[model samples]
Target: MRAEPESAPYARLGGEDAVRKLVNRFYDLMESEAQWQTPLRAIHPQDLSESKEKLFLFLSGWLGGPDLYVQRFGHPRLRARHGAFPVDDRARDQWMACMLQAMREVEMAPELYVHLRDAFQRTADFMRNR
Candidate 1:
């Protein structure tokens, strides 16, 4: 039998455990990092538990592991969902900063690091309302 080809980004990213760590770190950075905490963290609920889970579910499917978010909540409608908040350039940049720090903390591969940084930038930029 042929050796299996590399799996999706999720597996390459170390699956649920790694993804959970990344998400938690992402939130932790948002809550603790001085540069991003004010604008970005201010947008989140005072408590981050639910926000953390939602991002985890979203990223799980986004990374091609499981479609938990869609399965549980239907289409993400991410922008619509986020529309209630003001997501200007400052917000997007702050979010990217937090994610980049989290990615580094997780020690992701170089290629995947660049890929996620760019992808996250695009997604975060697209979320901008201003």
Candidate 2:
């Protein structure tokens, strides 16, 4: 268990191990799930290794754990990094579906899941360029 209070999303999430599990599950679903085979999976690289690591790092910081992403890559520059991708409603929805399912599969607490879901929704909405 993490030293952070249980109320901390990172601690409630079981710290680094849980975060890794969530990221892996999210990418696995995107790769294997038929529903995400279009724009969502298509937007990703043929090799998901880099993509998975980036997300794991980003989520680690975003969820209030160590800021590994920023430490290693500097500021996330989220919009700038994702600007090249053609993100639309369909792609956003597909991403959300996979993430929501991954969270559930990882057995995240309902309250924390809802909180992260809302946060992710806003982020995904902003990612939409069309």
Candidate 3:
């Protein structure tokens, strides 16, 4: 018997809603965690509500769902937008730590969790400008 083709984990994880939860938890950690509180506090806006929504919408399209971000905000030159900040290894690691904690809080399949974590790590690394 042939094996099934691997579907994109994002789709299997329920797409937009799952992605939204992940983003929400990530920001929650940034808001609460001491290690991240300082750096992220300076970088992020006083209110993260809109930022969280934007991330959720952006990830919805980025994970191969509806292109909501582009439809609303045009191109997502992520690096360009984030370039204004000093994102070094410490910042990247802090972001990943928050994301990982968020992933754990969400009830995703283990395989999907690992897949998403790895993907986020790579993306976070790429986002580092300093």
Estimated TM-score for each candidate: 0.93, 0.94, 0.89
lDDT tens digits, residues 10-109, model 1? Answer: 7788888999999999999898878887679889999999999999999988888888899999999999999999999999988988899899999678
TM-score pick, better of 1 and 2? 2
Q: Please provide, for model 2 over 1-130, each residue's C-alpha lDDT reduced to its tens digit, 9 standing for 90 to 100.
A: 2345667788889998999999999998898889899999988899999999999999988888888899999999988898898899999999999999999999777899899999999999988987
lDDT by residue for model 3 (37-85), tens: 7566568889998899889878877776777788899999999989999
What count of clashes does model 3 give?
0
Q: Output the lDDT of residue 18, model 3.
A: 81
Q: Lowest summed-lDDT stretch of 10 residues in model 1?
A: 1-10
lDDT of 2 at 5: 60
Which candidate comes out best when scored by lDDT?
2
Candidate-wise lDDT, in order: 0.88, 0.91, 0.82
The reply for model 1, stretches above 4 Å from the true place, is 1-5
**In candidate 1, which residue pairs clash?**
none
